[model samples]
Target: MTAIPVSAITIVGLGPGSMDDLTLEARRVLAQAAHDKQTVYFRTIIHPTVEPLKQDLPELRIESFDRLYDESDDWSSLYQQIATEVCDLALQHPIVYVVPGHPLVGETSVQLVLEQARKRGITTRIVSGLSFIEPVCNLLALDPFEVGAQIIDATNLAISHIDEVAGKIIPTIPLMIVQVYNRRLASEVKLALGECYPDEWPVKLVRAAGVGEEEAVLEMPLYELDRNNFANHLSTLYVPPVPELSALRLPETLRYITMRLRREPDGCPWDRQQTHDSLKRYVIEETYEVVEALEENDMDKLAEELGDLLLQVYLHSEVARQADEFTLGDVYEHVNAKLIRRHPHVFGTVEVDNSSQVVQNWEAIKKQERASAGVDVHNESVLDRVPQATPALMVAQEYQKRVIKTGFEFTSLQDVYAKLEEELEEIKQAASPEEQLEEIGDLLFMVAKLAGFLKVDAEEALRLANRKFRRRFQTMESLAREEERPLTSYSRPEWEKLWARAKEAIASN
Candidate 1:
């Protein structure tokens, strides 16, 4: 068997649609390759320019690796296979690979082939031709440089990528997105874009640019992208710059209200049976979710969790409405009025410099209002007003904060620390389990007070410490497993060694 001599790879750019659009260099290379009896391959002969050339060059072996693309479900895998095959063919014989427009522009297959050929020590030449971008720009009367343009593959649309493009690209500049292909892909593209651009943002869908039977430009709002039925492989999505901030609150509020209605007496049985007492834990859970959302800086999750939290409020309000106490509307009206009343600086003539002063003013106004409403105002103890339903740590912290405000608390951090130490000593000296438990509670209360004085939320501080301890202990357990020992079988001294190692590892990280 005779081994075929390896041939140089020539990438020819067919330019857009017409032969007039083809560069002199691209035409020269194609003609020369034909004259030399070299095999000519078209990446895609579907282009109008390449369609006419088929007649002049009957022997031009067009690369219809379309079957490779058609057979593979994954485009990336197909592209890789196509590039590999082209490079293998180039290694065997001199080949002229023809691609639509500039081979260097938006041609991933050409890029792959060139890269693979380079690795195989195969000589490769790229003949540049007029790209579809230039022709599209001409058709739209757009200046690519002056207006600025971003060319993105439609298939690669993702929320984060769209956000990055929106952030970097100036809003005044137009964006040209190529290879939209289908409605599902178009919808995905729209959803990604919807995060940055408004739902009503104008987008132009252009198909078959520079071709004679080219369809007229179709216009639609960004939200109605899927509604446009003319999207295809040769289509491009053009998005004009948007300046408006997307309204995110209204839909969230609607969702909250709808969920509550769905769970009403005439709705879900589980939800209908729920009362204020039964749903108490849900309120606390939703509040924590809101805190988590805020901590994570996740606006979408925050919006969702906030809706859950709102549902709790509306749930309680609906229960109250059943008992003829208050309706959901009444709950809103009360809170809205309370906020306006409390922020006298905003709703009234009262002037306040900072948040602290505003809080003080609010408390003062609340005391006066409670007295007028025939509510008790002669609360003697600092802890008297604290809600019994609140978590023990939070209640203790609130009691301490109230006492400190009245200048009837510990003088300094040292004083609070000494009190905690005293409680610990009492716990150690306790004669019975009941006495010990009481002392331990006292100790915890003092610790919560100290945490409050330090401007730390006692509940959250404890929760974080609990999480850290669990993580460290888990690491210790894993280390024990590595040592072929169970955590339960380890002695105190051995456990301490592993725990220390875990802490050290955590600190190092």
Candidate 2:
């Protein structure tokens, strides 16, 4: 056979499902190629319309290549080979390739052929047909332009990408995702969507649209998508926007208080004068109260205290906004950005083998950030990092740790005990009250340091001791009351006898 000069590679779209749906131009191009004895190839003949074409055009050299399953490992390689064979045939004669629906709409094979032919300097022509998108919209009774719709492929939906799109896209707009092939793929889509949309958000599954035996539209929650057990290669997932639930109005008393506090001229004098700095102590105090409630295992109290702590944050942010320094949004942005930056193991390429390395990297980054902000670095001591307003015992413990880090600390527990004894003797020998107070303070500081070396929290240990003393003293008071004698009227020997009884009663309990 002699090679003929190939003029053009014609690409035709064989509309969705029905033969009548094919455009006049598409039919003309396909028929012309058949008359010219050129090769006529159909991308797929799985549709009912193309099935009739095979019977009617038996002598027309019609080729239906739908038997090649897409789930095969070498599907792309098969497509490349098919395109190569078509290009080889075109070198000897003109060739026509037909694809389902519009050739430009998600038709990877058609795109491959066009691109490869262009590189080989072969002319190409594309004939458009009715796409599945229009028919799908008509069936679902949705207006894409009016409601604002986003179309995406189901294969591309991953957890991270879905989160990104969900956060940025307007919540009012609906989403239409295509190419959901199977139940496994549907499950992945559901998992990704659940990140933003509620699990109960309604979704519609559409399959093999515009065909006589096509599946009926199935509606279910996003979470129940996989449970429905209905999906195929032609399936599309439609996610509807969830409507916000109505919230109850605030109580009249609470509303009045909020209004009065926010009032420009008639607000309370003390409330109007407050700023972020003025409310800082209250924020810290409320946070500690919440922590205490949690430790006590009082769920109801914890809930109430947590709300109070949150209100402190809101109040401070509102005050800052009035001062023109920043708003709650700015505060949130800074903290969120800081968290993401500090956790490079979570958000960046930093390789951290363990939690210890993560902590070290975080501290290093924080120090660098502080240095860059022009905060004193060289002259700044670690002790200064402990906030001045922190509880005195906490500050003492923190200060001791800073000094120990600098290799200025005393040796062992025995050495610390000896120093404590020496401080006690000095307190006894002091001539002035101030000197005696200073010696006692030195003894307490040394005790705190010893507690740190022993891996004990000095504040907590002291708190427990105080509670024990209070309980024992309460028992003694109760005993005196039962004995028909007042605690203050008891003699030294009588009080000692009551104290022993209290101890015995506690041990029995």
Candidate 3:
């Protein structure tokens, strides 16, 4: 242990407000601090043991910060200021810092105190006490270790999106949610958890566990968590382990499937041989199929195509994981963080009028994020993130879309049409093949920008034109065959007659 000095600080927990729950060492530290006339400060004096401690240590001058909770609007800043005060007071005298539960568990102030104290070269000591988790386990009649319990703070569950696991928790395990300080927070927790757990699933709410004042334990459907008015600082939630396996239970099922395909010695050779580069074609293929299903307006086909697309993701991710590049969790974390950070209208207090404003705000947020990461994004090309592998027509449209955001695009389709006409004239006047090629490409790009201005999908438009031509030509060939003449044997006049009839046939249909 570090040598105790006049500047040393001893931190203790009051053990969930029950006198019997306080450990012997914690009590001894309080007694010694009182006997020596050292400063003893309680983070809050609202605990049941506060009066008992006052009677036991009559000489102790215990200061309380209960009023700070009411005085400060921001809990983060409040905890920060308290930590500064604790470190400053410790420098002048040996002190005892007491809080309601174990100092290391869910106490933000204690963490800040340790960080500040360490930076100032102050000696610190910890005397652990019983935390609310112990009594909660007792009430549940279950061993946390045996049940594979996962404990989380309700505050974190309320504000942040969970990306590492399903249901915001590990599956096949019990979960203990602590620090549910109000009904609003309880409702938020229930909503976030509802993504992974059924709304009708039973959940237990425990309040003031091991305290003298009545401990309330209520079992209700998860949907009703915010209905009753039993929430307080001491409230906690218990989610029992799922009885049967489910898709929502774990994402690990997909991970396991991928693992067996690649890890087993007798696995399919095609799967075992796939690398990131080798699987790229399948990723692109599956994505286009999904798009095709959407274009056809078929939900059944869309679902099957979506699964195939997911398979591509799992295969590529597993390949990278095997190569020690990254895990699948890293993929979702990147996207989840981007979603929360970009959509301030949802996750934060920012308000907006329409989707247009949301798009502008998203770009602004992305720029700010880049600046924070020490990137000079203003110097980078506006089309830098558009993938090279994307379809050429789609890429062209995206280029025009992004450039418009930078205030450097045609204001209307009239300007796009003018550019297209100018490029077509340039292509016709070109002497060299290279010059003609360059001008032709420019003309196509202008065409794509015009399509974008008209709110049309340039790529899909080209696909439809290609389909129409193929269908007409096939009909022409069939007419030639019916007339006992090969399509190649037809004269220009005969071919024209067949093509006109084919067009008339399709137009009539």
Candidate 4:
């Protein structure tokens, strides 16, 4: 037994609601405080240990923050209130702040008190006791370390986004969610876990652990978790691993699978042989497939194509990992940082009147970033940022788009139209095939610039026109087939009639 300094705030745990589990040191500390007529404060007097402790030590001056719970609807605010009051009392006199379970296990009030007290130059000591984890693990007949169990706060998991939860949860391991407290929270937890876990996944509810006859363990499907009012303050839900379903449910599982596929002699030969340079084509292909799915307005195809695109990213990341260049984490970090850094109007204190202003701000931030990174900003042209491998039409449009940011644009649509006409006339006046090619290129460039002046995407406009032509031509071919005549044998008038019929059919549709 060691002496707890009378000048400091000594925090004690009353164990997991069982008097037999309470530490001798905790008992001695309370006795010592009782003898000194010092008040012992409990975070709540509702714990089973509280009434028993009072009966065991009649002279113990016990007080509690149970009234704070009744007064405040928000648990966060209630914990803060208790912490502030406890720290305030510690300033006037030595305080003994007792809570259920180990002070550090899941005691928010104890954590707050410790932080606030220390910041105010007050000393605090933690008297350890058996936490709920030990008894819960014993009841479940599993070792937490062996199962690699994740202990999550039910309140936190209940309120978090599915994506944020996905990043934390791994379905191929044991999960222990603590502080279920009530059915309402259990429902929220059920819905949250359902996002990644099957609704019918088996789970265990262990309540009042280590508290003798009051302790109960119930097994049920995850979907039925909140169907009854069995959940209480001492409840903990244990989720066992579902390895077969993990790949389909968990985001981390995909990362692990990608890594495993690249592992050694037993791994996939094709995946093992891939390099970043070789996988570049797959990235471009998957990207266009995603765009095609979007253009077709197919949600299911979009989701599937997006997964394919994501796989390419994972493949490239794995290759980089093998070469000791970078990892997937670095990719996410760089892009996330860039997004937050460039979006001042959304992330920072900056405000914008319109999207045009947002674009200007983005460009300005990019320039600042390049200059700060010691790039030769003076020698770099804005057009150099456009990827050379983009489609020809897209590349042409991007060139005009970037140059226009420097205020090199036609002030009026009439000027744009005049430039287009001038280029067309030059194309007609060309005397050689080489000059004709050059004039045609100039004409196309002028058309791209005209598209920008009209606030239209030249590439998208061309794609739409191409799709229309394909549809009309397919209709004309069907008409020719129905007439039992070959398209090659059709004369000019016949072709014109076929085209008119196809156009009329398309407009009717």
lDDT of 1 by residue, 1-509 (tens): 22333248878788767777778777667666555666677765566786667676665555566576457666446557878888888778777788877888777778889889889988988888888787777667788788678777665553245546455434445788876766776887887776656788888888778775674578888888888677875677888864322323333344345455655456667766778899999999999889878866899999889989987887787777767887778876888999998888998898888999988998899889988989778864556768898889988888877877788777788998889899999998999999988999999998898888789999988878887998898888778889898888988898788889999988988
Q: Whose TM-score is greatest here?
A: 4
Task: Give Cα-based local distance difference scores for all models.
Answer: 0.75, 0.73, 0.83, 0.87
Q: 364-423, model 2: which lDDT tens digit per residue?
A: 998889999998787887777778877767778989887877997887789888988888
Which ranges in model 2 have alpha carbons more than 4 Å from their true place?
A: 1-173, 180-203, 206-230, 245-282, 293-324, 327-329, 336-364, 422-444, 459-509
Q: Estimate the lDDT of model 4.
A: 0.87
Candidate 3 residue-pair clash tally: 0
| Per-model TM-score on C-alpha atoms | 0.50, 0.57, 0.57, 0.84
Candidate 2: RMSD to truth: 9.0
Q: Using TM-score, rank the candidates from best to worst.
A: 4, 3, 2, 1
Q: Counting only residues 3 or more apart in sequence or on different chains, how many pairs clash (N, Cα, C under 3 Å) in candidate 1? A: 0
lDDT of 4 by residue, 1-509 (tens): 34556646889998888999999989999988877777899987777898887888888999998787557765446677998999899889888999888999977778789889878999988999889999999899999998788888786687678677777787778899987878887998998898778899999999999999999999999999999999987898999988843648666777888998999988899999999888889999999999889988999999999999999988889899999999999999999999999998999999999999998899889989999999888899878878888987789888887887798878899998999999999999999999999999999888888887888898888888988999999999999999999999999999999999999999999
* Ten-residue stretch with the least lDDT total in model 2: 244-253
| Shift in Å, residue 230, candidate 3 | 2.0
